[model samples]
Target chain A: MNPRRRRGIRGNTSIVESVRLTKIYGSGDISTVALNDVSFEIQRGEFVLIVGQSGSGKSTLLHMIGLLDKPTGGRILIDGIDATFLSDSDRSEVRRHKIGFIFQAFNLLADLTVVENVMLPMMMIGNGASSAMRGEAELVLGKVGLAKQVEKQANQLSGGQMQRVAVARALVNRPALVLGDEPTGNLDSKSSQDVINLMKELNRELKQTFVIVTHAREAFGNVDRTIVLKDGKIESIE
Target chain B: MDFRLVLATKLLLKRKGNFIASVTALVIGVMVILFNSLIFNGVAEGILRDLADYQFGHVLVSKNDGNFVNEDLQLISYVQTFSYVEAAAPRLGSIAWMNSTEGASLNEVDKIVIIGVDPLRDPKASLLYSTVNEGSFVASRGQLVLGSNVASDLKATVGTRVDVKMVTASGEDAIRQFVVVGISKSPGGLAFDDSAIMTVEDIREITGRERETDQILIKLTDRSFQNELKSRLSNAYAEENLNIQTLEEAGEETLAGIRSGIAFINLVGYFGLLSASFAIVTIMMLMVSNKTKDIGIIKSLGGKSTDVLIIFILQGLIIGSIAALSGFIVGSIVGLYLQSIEFSFGPGLVLEVVYDPVFTLNSSLFSVVLGTGAAVYPALRASKLQPIDAMQHS
Candidate 1:
């Protein structure tokens, strides 16, 4: 109710709202709750981290918010719209125009070139295919310092380069929210730091919203806020 | 330029071995079908064409009485005037037992139909004139042309004297003496030039029917006009009760057999192509399974299921189309090679390989359709894959 308090949380603007979000796997006695009525808010342009042990369901939460999976109960709101129960195509539309994802494995299609990988979001969004999309891809790749290697295939890149390429792809559509599931987990320490630093720079210079899930504690020191999970429930916000 | 097609092409091209395997299976299946089409269609057409040329002459008109027919030849004259009619002729026929009076041991032939024809006009009606290998076509009342089979049985030459006789209903025998003026050799066909050819005068003199004609033959410029001509002729002879028929109508039993043969061959071809399509389906299933993570990644990037479907379908269509077109070329080559080989299929049944391979734009389009259609189930399954599940699969 107070604008002053709101200003402190997400600069008075919330871009994502999770209300009693619950995800249960299996059924009856064997059912395991991946997300147990957990609720949280992520603000516009804020860098947030979700941290927990492997079974604590941090990745499940990421998948729910990413629109890649549906929860058994509760709902998620992206940019103030109820996205939890949206139809598959509608969800795809939202995902295309509004959200970006970075996979821990750097899941770039090996058959495609780096530029093609980056061009994917724009193509999926169904704006007319043009050279400008590729030109925009070039600019994003340049931002990730992969301008010269655009022609290289996904497999030709190192772990760090592939992650950076993934980041470029994530930002290619200029999505309102970017989600990463341990984006730096597959990298060497040096490469992991390089990827983290690039994301930090992109968040600052572009004011891009980011919610990255990571077990790497080093990432906690760099983000605006941290949500820690224990037993599929939020234990603390720091 | 579509991203789905671009992705599909890249995927298949990178996995060149899989692509080639899919194409090879499809090509072999389609080639077999095409080859069967060629051989079966070629043989059927050849046999029909030979019948038309030598026996049926595109249309046949038969009378109830084999040895008797019209006195004025008015039916022949009327049909010959039609624009579609190329030629028409009446063949006077009689079943007679001919024995050689010259030999003490009779050269016997039982139940032979001696066809009497006008030497000048019969060439247009049948292939008998062309089959004559010795002597000449029937010219006068004392002359006759013996079929090669008959000549062999008679032990006679072109100049050999033969006695011909047929018993009438009155229990009296009508006997005639004639010299064989021509020996006709038969190549495998409906006519086989087996029946002896005689002058209309000899048949008339023997049968005592001045204008006895058993069958009327008509040659048409366009055989498709046969039905219309048959209708017209039937209407004109509504009271005469003459049996006027198209070649197809006359040879219904043979045509039906041929149709069944084609259907059986097509059934085999269908199974061949069906198994090939299953091979494609398996190939696509494996490809989609292997690319589960890629599908998840794509879905996360906002690629629609329809887009994924289009990718796999395009891959199948491209493979099918290329293989089918190449199959046409390969099958045709094989058909021609088969036609070139010769074999003896016993006595009068020599194997004649005709070369008319069946292919059309429809078949080519069908290949493309078949290729893509076979991929639909796999493609739909690929599209329905859960993004989260796929991403987590590996």
Candidate 2:
């Protein structure tokens, strides 16, 4: 509802754009290219998946797009702003305003309550613990089917429940883009299917762009697009 | 509450054992420092009290190059005229030999310093009357008050007749018999331990030195006026060839030694704080290692590096403040207990613990700064961690 956020939402249809992004690990003879000149674009309100094998740079591309890791070459743009050259503080600001991330391990701060975990992004963006932020967090948790577990410590939750808390946390800020790197990788098959269905449902309802990287391509059933990579290079886009 | 503080509290609570250990370390450090400071204060206070109450009154005025100051009554009257001077009394100091005669037989002979005081005026200028352990202070010309050690050495008691022998001012040997009236135990160091007190008139009559005394002891209404009174006395008696000294000036060497001892205690206390700081550093480093995943999660949630830094720093600060306050309370309780007990170093020196509020507050503040400083490196390391790398850490 803030003027700046409204301006951001109205500014661009392309939520994310990666142009020849490359990330290399190590150096000299032992150096390995984690991502090699990978290029992609994700539009607003699109549900997209990045599919590849274990070493195919799917997580790398997702990390770069989320602004959690910088590309060694090329550039990344989030909500039409060039993000690759942003300072660490500026990158954090961009990430706070424009992107949300969910990891395979759920990555909830175990010591915090589920509501607290969900309220973290909003608090980090200087919203404080205002009743509005708290209400929004509770609303998001309710949407993720975690209304009853909101007061429980994150560590006390089951994998499915913890992932639901993570989902609530990711969407609490209503970011323009949400990135997931194997979000359901550690869940049971039923739990995984349930989480994927929840994510699809939330995407349909919220119309926020979602970029997910995973090995279980068939589980997605249908998405707006899928970017396939092989050996750190983009092989195809469907 | 700020999210950083809330997260820091939760993080510290999550590791209860480490948190308690860190607090205990800092508490011990603060207690050690406070204990050392209190002991130093106690010893210094005991020494100064002994000097002011028994040996040196607040100011001592003596002849610069003679055994006695002539016209002592006039000098006493002149000194007492000052509003700050509570009382002025004359004292005559002489080395003498004493032997106790019980049953018409001399039991033991001892060499002693004899101090002659004005019976009425001396009581106002010194705590001699209160220090009498048995009988009472000298009230008449022949009455004698014996120090504890001198009384023990001479095998004398209240009502015992003792012969005191001394060389007169005219270089003639003189002897007089006196009955002991009191046994006084003044822990004003060795000076008062091997001495005896009697009426100034009695000493003058025995030594054939009438109307003269060794020193004029001046007690002040407040001890802080010692220097000002000394300066005024010096100026007033500039033509009298007198040496005027303040209590501090007279006890300079002993005070210097005590100062050195305090410095050493402060060094030891700082070393204790340094060791505690090291424990904090190690504990904070371990905390950062254990919370790497949390750091990554926070950063991934759009927390800046400064946010992570502030969280860790706040943890250290909270621990330090709690420990410091606990240590101060515990230390004060222990100091009060110590104040109830008496510690005697020798025949006439007893010490009781003392506490100063300003010193205690400064010590606690120092501990807080050290604790906060100890966390800087670990905080920086946590703040600088890359979100991706930290998330990958298992």
Candidate 3:
């Protein structure tokens, strides 16, 4: 284990758990191995990074864990509840009420205002936003240093500011887990570092669980532990 | 506003090209249907009004002979005093031969339906007197009025005398001499333009139908009273000597023909709207395709499939409402424009088209429903987009 990895036995409750997870692309002879028999558990409030080269299944693993895609075999437990058996709508409900996603390209609906973007999760939770249920999206926007930009549309912001807006949106629901798939993929070095520092700050302060998939090591150096993958298998834990 | 609608509005407002195309399709569709339906509706109303005003005269009372009035002058005169009778008049008609005194046999026309009217009450019962342009209506027994076509055929003019010959009810050949006093125009542009009019005394003298009239024409305070009058007449004159019927009965076959033509017109309108709905589906599908990534983002943000569907459907509904309202306004104006058109048909028949467009609630509702329904498939396709596929697309 890397020196920065915390030394501990995760106690009674884990926010997420994966058991013998397997994913394949096609059927029979033409099939490709994307992930193979991978298993892991995530403690609440832990900051974890899944690191690998391109096509090494880091993104695939993130997708499966986040419920963005289905696994070919194995089970995923979110907040200690088996999610593998949930209906499609139920899985969407789980994503709505429990999980938050941060995409690399900062998918902050460009047509929506920054505040409106932050309220997206809450709106979708209602399916058709109740507007009465809009909690503290503004507070989360303020926390991401976008207090003054709340009324501005998402497209009006810069790369770093857009990512911050997205971060604000992801955390507005106070979800149990936040999954980032190459969160800084489209940003400059400084913008990438700003987004990473912001995620770490929010993780520490809010004590929210995080699982990020990335190849960048410098920005994620302070994560609690990093799972290193090579050729669809975990090579080591750093 | 629900966030679904809010997002839907934002998407449409932000995408000017798609929004304009969608709205244009709907507007053009509704406009075509409205304009066509209005024009046909106006034509049907004009035809029916013409029949009611100039041909039918609300109700007609006839006898078994059909041409000569049965000797029931007392009941007709009695009906004239009733509250429902705006005007009641006796008319005598016979198939006669007429020729101008100055012209040879070439000027004679056979099978001329010559009708005699009372100069006093006929004007109130039939609006034909109002159409007399150059002469006074039949003023007395020896006077006659000629329709434009009949005047042309007989080579008769004002102050010209004509000889009318017919077989009387007694089976004897009889004749009368009539001086043409006026040339009357036919308001209806119908075959009546080929008929002649004279005093009831003139037709009676020629047909030997002493003190007998052929048909009793009645105009009522309200046309709806015809059915009640028909029943009352049947109860009073149930002997089959007198028959009461609505003027519409005379042209039921013609009206049925016109109705079929109007049905075809309505069908064409429906097809126009159908093509327009297809256009909506095509353009909306394009919009959905362009915004697939947006779909994924919404899904990732916790939006359900139903929310996405609502957004797209709401966009279409908005377009439909705006287009339908605008089309209705424009169609009303067009109906007014068409109402002003006066054109002539067949030999001196100047028709003033009375265009009264009728818009039904069901038609407007149908437009809205069709416009919104056309977008359903596109919306469903957009809603079915996988969040992962959307994210991958970008």
Candidate 4:
């Protein structure tokens, strides 16, 4: 890590870091370390791709970074705040206001329509944000090409369409970081391209940080950097 | 969480079949509990009013051997003592034969209990007087008030003179001639339907009874003190060979039998309602199981465990409230309908059922409490579910 190399990304800053993060499941002889001494820095407005095979610790790492889970050891810093020391409710606040997540399964609440799913985060803010933020939700959906399908239920949408709805929902709050885990895993190639392009567009236009975990090489087209994880360790950062 | 509430309600609506089933189970539970309360309250009121109006006048005093006071002079002395005592009267009772000439004619005569009463102190007198149609209860010399059944049986009208043959208390048979001064309709049932009423002296002379009464009817200032007064009087007049008893204690064995019978019915009714509560629990547990995945999703999306608890609790409250209100409405309607019909108990006692408003409200509240109580376990389980496991649930 040369100072000159770090200085090349001028005026841009890293909002996340995993300081010797480790996660172990089980105990005694059967202990399995899911994440071992994993460390990385993700900068603002950077569309970084994490490429890995199955069980390569990609999802677990992404989950830890997104504050959806707690690391068994080590501290995760988000925006210079020590996230591991925060309370469960405080962690939830960080997850709500600071980060957005898109899942490979397109975890849209099936009971809600596309528009309601997009308004999901706004509603979760608990201040009755629906009345005030509805227009923003509509605009985000329009950006994701889901304006026509807004009233249709999530269950009625195709795999690709559901992924797009999930994306709209993730970005509805205008979060600082968008952490997607295999977001295009279940979509067709064309839909995957559309979703990937949308993420890139959001990162470029909104100066939003993007950290995506995926195995599809085609989905990472023209990303600023790719961090390849292998056997619970970083293999390369290109 | 605002989103959790909106999402939970949507999930409930989406799973409409499960929601309907759960609500139905709760409604049935509520109905059973409410119906039992209505029946119990109705029977209590029904029996108490019937005894108070037709048989016991709040209290009764009598000789230890159950003989009526026959000396008119002694009776007046006893009657003048208590200022709080509203009415005191002596009655002589005996079994007699009644042969009905209409409605049904059997060769075997119907046995009826004859009562000797002071016409002025009898509440039944007004009702009997109104039903007379042809006679008066003036208790003139050698006159009688014959019940409708007895009058019909003997084919006797107010002016008809009939012979009443009976044995005096001395075990001697006597036949007395008397004009039917009044013909009164029977009060559906009790012991006196086919009975007749005579002056105290008439019963004593005919029965050869000497200064004895079957019972003394004592009306008190407060009906609740009937038992207390009966005990006190029994102690006060221990030497007089008189026994005082409240209507409930007087018919102790009978009332105990009635109470036990009603209690057994109520126990069975509660058992059924408890099983209905179990059904409600089952439905709620199923709801929790079905929504496990949705719960996980919401938790992951910033729902606290408390938020989950609120959603389920609100659902249970809604279900319980609706069921309680519906059960109350339906139960009252049914109870009121049953009250509209007049039923006979036994000889001079007809039961007119009255729907108790207090019981209705209490039963409604009971249903709500029971239904909500049934949901507490399931709601708690829903709240304690792990977000990770719940999310992974299919």
- Residue by residue across A1-238, what tens digits does model 3's lDDT show? 0112222225566777878888999999999889998888888899999998898999999888887788899888778667776665666777888899998888877888888888777876654335443447877877888889988989999988998988888888889999998999889999998889999999999999999998797777788989988888888887
Q: Which candidate is the best by TM-score?
A: 2
Model 4, residue B367: distance off in Å is 3.9
Q: Of the pair 1 and 3, which is ahead by lDDT? A: 1
TM-score of chain A of each: 0.93, 0.93, 0.91, 0.91
Tens-digit lDDT string for candidate 2 (B54-118): 77789988888874546777877888888999998888877788888667667665567889988
Answer with 3 or 4, whichever has the higher TM-score. 3
Task: Grade the docking of candidate 2.
Answer: medium
Candidates sorted on TM-score, descending: 2, 3, 1, 4
Model 1 lDDT tens row, A133-153: 999999999999999999999
Query: Model 4 over residues A1-238: C-alpha lDDT tens digits?
Result: 0111122123344677777888887898998888888877777788888888888888888878877678899878776557876766676677777788888888888888888887878887755546666677788889988788888989999998899888888888888888888899888888999888888888889998989999896656788888888878888889
Leading candidate by lDDT? 2
Consecutive 10-residue window with the lowest summed lDDT within model 2 chain A: A1-10
- Per-residue lDDT tens digits for candidate 1, residues B215-329, read 7788899989999998998888787767887898776766688778988998898788888888988988888888888888888888878888898898888888887787767
Chain A, candidate 2, TM-score of 0.93
lDDT at position A71, candidate 2: 83
**Each prediction's whole-model lDDT (CA):** 0.81, 0.86, 0.78, 0.71
CAPRI level of candidate 1: medium
Docking quality class, candidate 4 = acceptable
